[model samples]
Target: MKKILVTGATGQLGSSVIETLLKKMIESQISIITRIEEKRVQFQAKGFNAFRASYDDVVSLENAMEGVDTVLLISSGDQGDRMQEHRNVIDTAKKTGVKHIAYTSRCLNNRNTLANKLMVEHFETEDYILSTGLKYTIFRNILYMDAIPQFIGGNIALERGIFLPAADGKVSFALRSEIGEAMANVLLSEEIENKIYNFTSDKAYSFYDIATALTDLSGKTVKYTSVETNVFEGMMKQRNLPEPVILKIVDFITDIKHNQEAGIFNDLEIILGRKPSGLKNGLKTLFGL
Candidate 1:
């Protein structure tokens, strides 16, 4: 019996992964690792083996990995020092004698311009993980379709338009839940060392394409307005967004404009045994219309 432990167990992706796991295997084969005691208790109440562990604390992570055959090290949420936190988890996983590790990484291609500052950490982490000589599977996930409304701002529907600094770049976005489910499938499979999978939808869409979809679906006129990068930053600042966050958003939009996220891969379908969700349907579910 393989004992699989999932770190960051309370997060959106982690929780969805756990939901998929529960359907495929017994709860006794799964363990949840979370920093919050309340969340641990919540999982425990639902008949799961939950442990308290923080990526910042090596001892807690090692203790949590005890007797665990495979581990899902979901990337940390902290932006500033996430690489270090991931390092801790990887090192501790190696030290604790874990057999396999599956990591959630960002999708980055050969385009140098697409390599934003935040993406550098993922590359470095992948290099480090490969150096450890441990069996690892890296899932390079694309941007989530759920984030479209947020990226366009909250008033997209009301304003009947989408606004962004991004030019005409297309992104093959997948639902977070779908990606999580596929990842659960990977974790449950036989150990494959140093394999990389791109978790993205079959079709890609631009912001203008999204506006068209909205207009067609909602019976309302929606437009995609491309703004200058500086102007977009000013708009975010007017909304009282912090400087660091504003910069990150700007860089991400710039990457999109450069067509950084336009890759379509079939790995998702291979794992799920069906085609991943489409953009129009995903947007419909997101907008609740």
Candidate 2:
């Protein structure tokens, strides 16, 4: 049987892709590269092929990719030097003579955008794959909406009949599961080739749209407050969040306020051969409303 290797198998995205793949093929043919030894028995019990590897360690990568025909590299979340880390995997895959490698990238490296910083690194990784003259596909995923959390004070406000933090900026949020399914389709479909696919839901919504949904479903007077970036970060710090994480959150919000652009809707539907799920549905799933 041809082997398909999935890197970062213990991660959220990697784990979902492997689950989807198993629905179509036996786990024996699905190889997972991960450093966590505790998951080895779990994968073994499920009949998956597992290998011990690390992106920072080239020898570990080469050994993992041995005899693997295809590789699905879920981007490393290690924001520090991610480009070089991804290069390590790409180089090892090439050395192992892998036929096709699929990379999880972002949509549109549109030079002037803040998303560009994130997008460009993925592009660099894409460039490395192309340089090797290897067959590849790119799954450019959008933001996942399921990861949102209610602010700490929002609980008291909800009890007091006041919902807060109505961000006015528009957001194009897609479910991670949808992206996972599309990645699996890309891996399995023969019709797709050396090309790039931008994965997003059909609708792009603003923060008010989310607020409106929350109010309608939860029957609570939830409010969306548009606060300055500094204020938001200060509040998070006051709540005892770590400085580094708070800074990342602040930077992310600043990006959203200034650079959250309208996203492409067709690529995801076309790839999956179905309509992508809507934000309302996602909200309902998350909030039980």
Candidate 3:
């Protein structure tokens, strides 16, 4: 059996991708590479093969990818030194002679905005992956609708109903399950090598629409308050959010709301061969409504 290894299996996207792959492929043929042993155990209990690995450690990565047919490098969440971390994984995969390499990247490759960090990293990653002369697929994932609950919970805790710096800009946020299926399709298919798959929902919506969705789902009068970037930063500070983190986050939000770069794509539906889940269905599952 050919083994397909997934790095960062503890993360939301990675875990979902692994589950989707195993459901389609044999359990023994799917592997999870993670830094945490507990997470590995969870995969083992689910009848998956797990390997302890990290992006920073080249040797561990090589060992994890050893004899594996395909690899899905879920981009690291670490802000600092992430590029080097990704490079290490790519180099290790090359050395291990993996058949196909797939990466989860940002929605757009334009570097004209602050929300383009992932885009930059992904472009670099794609370049490096191609340089290795291996069969590769780049999944340029859009914003996830799974983030709604977290944003809503934070707003409620801060007593700031639908608080954000974004104005009328729409984000092409995709459902986790939809992305999972698309990734699985790419991983399982042998015909898509040397392809760049831009995975996003067919539609886009502003945060105000998000707030309205919440209100409609739970009957909570959540108001969309578009504050100035500085004002939003101050609000986060008032809520005792860490200074450095809030500064970066506020700047990202400012870019989106200011129309620096924001829109939707039909890539998800194209890849999955079906209509991707929308914001309402995503919220329904998230809120259990």
Candidate 4:
């Protein structure tokens, strides 16, 4: 079995990938990078070859990358210099003679208009990996259906209804867990090289559609109110949300209005071998209806 090292091993998507890989193959074939000693020990207990590494630290990355045949570079969070961290990972992968690399990027393929500043990192990372002379697969994942709770306030979502500045813009959302499972299959297949996939649901739905789904599932009258940007921000602030969190919520709504978040491609369905989860079912599951 080839040695496959996975970065972001403690994250939701990374954990899903690791779990699926362990089920499909032997533990010796999988390796995980985690800087936390407890997480490393937990993975070790599961018989995985867990290593200590951080994306920003080249020396640590080099130490963790030894004997890694393929590396899955799960993009780091938006905090700090994420683009530089990605560069370090790419450079280290090449230096350590890793044969194949896979990166999880955001939805949409156009470099025309980016959803946000951090999205630029995904596109730039794509360019950087293509320039590395290494075989690579890129998954341009869309908004996760699982993130609906966060997008709208999880606990008071039904009571609050949907209040965003995105207007009627539609989004193609898929569950992150299912996407992660499909990604694992792509990583293990050497045949899926040098390709970029748009990981999105088959249909695009607006917040209005989302509200309808929630209403049908929760038996509550959920309203979709497309307010002004400032109005939405003020609402969040009144709820005692921090500035950064308010900014993120506004950005997501703005991105949706700009058409950067909506996707119509079925690349994910092709990989999953079935229709991706629709809004009604996803909402039902999420809200425990």
- lDDT of all predictions, in order shown? 0.85, 0.74, 0.76, 0.86
Pitting candidate 3 against candidate 4, the one with the higher TM-score is 4
> After superposition on all CA atoms, what RMSD does each candidate show versus the true structure?
1.4, 2.7, 2.3, 1.4
Cα lDDT for residue 159, candidate 4: 92
Cα lDDT of model 1 overall? 0.85
Candidates sorted by lDDT, best first: 4, 1, 3, 2
Candidate 3 error regions (>4 Å): 45-47, 115-119, 152-160, 258-261
| TM-score for each candidate, following the candidate numbering | 0.96, 0.89, 0.91, 0.96
TM-score of 3: 0.91
Query: Residue-wise lDDT of candidate 1 within 132-220, one digit each (tens)?
Result: 99999999999999898889875465365777988888999999999999999888776566699999999889998898888877888
The 10-residue segment with the lowest total lDDT in model 4: 109-118
**lDDT of candidate 4 over 17-43, digit per residue (tens):** 988887677887888899799998988
Give the clash count for model 2: 5
lDDT for each residue of candidate 3 in 136-250, tens digit (9 for 90 to 100): 8888877778876665454362244776778786777888778978898778765655887778777877888887887787777768887777787787789798987786676
Deviation (Å) of 163 in candidate 3: 2.1
Q: What is the model-wide C-alpha lDDT for candidate 2?
A: 0.74
Pairs of residues at least 3 apart in sequence or in different chains that clash in candidate 4:
none
**Reference-based lDDT, residue 288, model 4:** 84
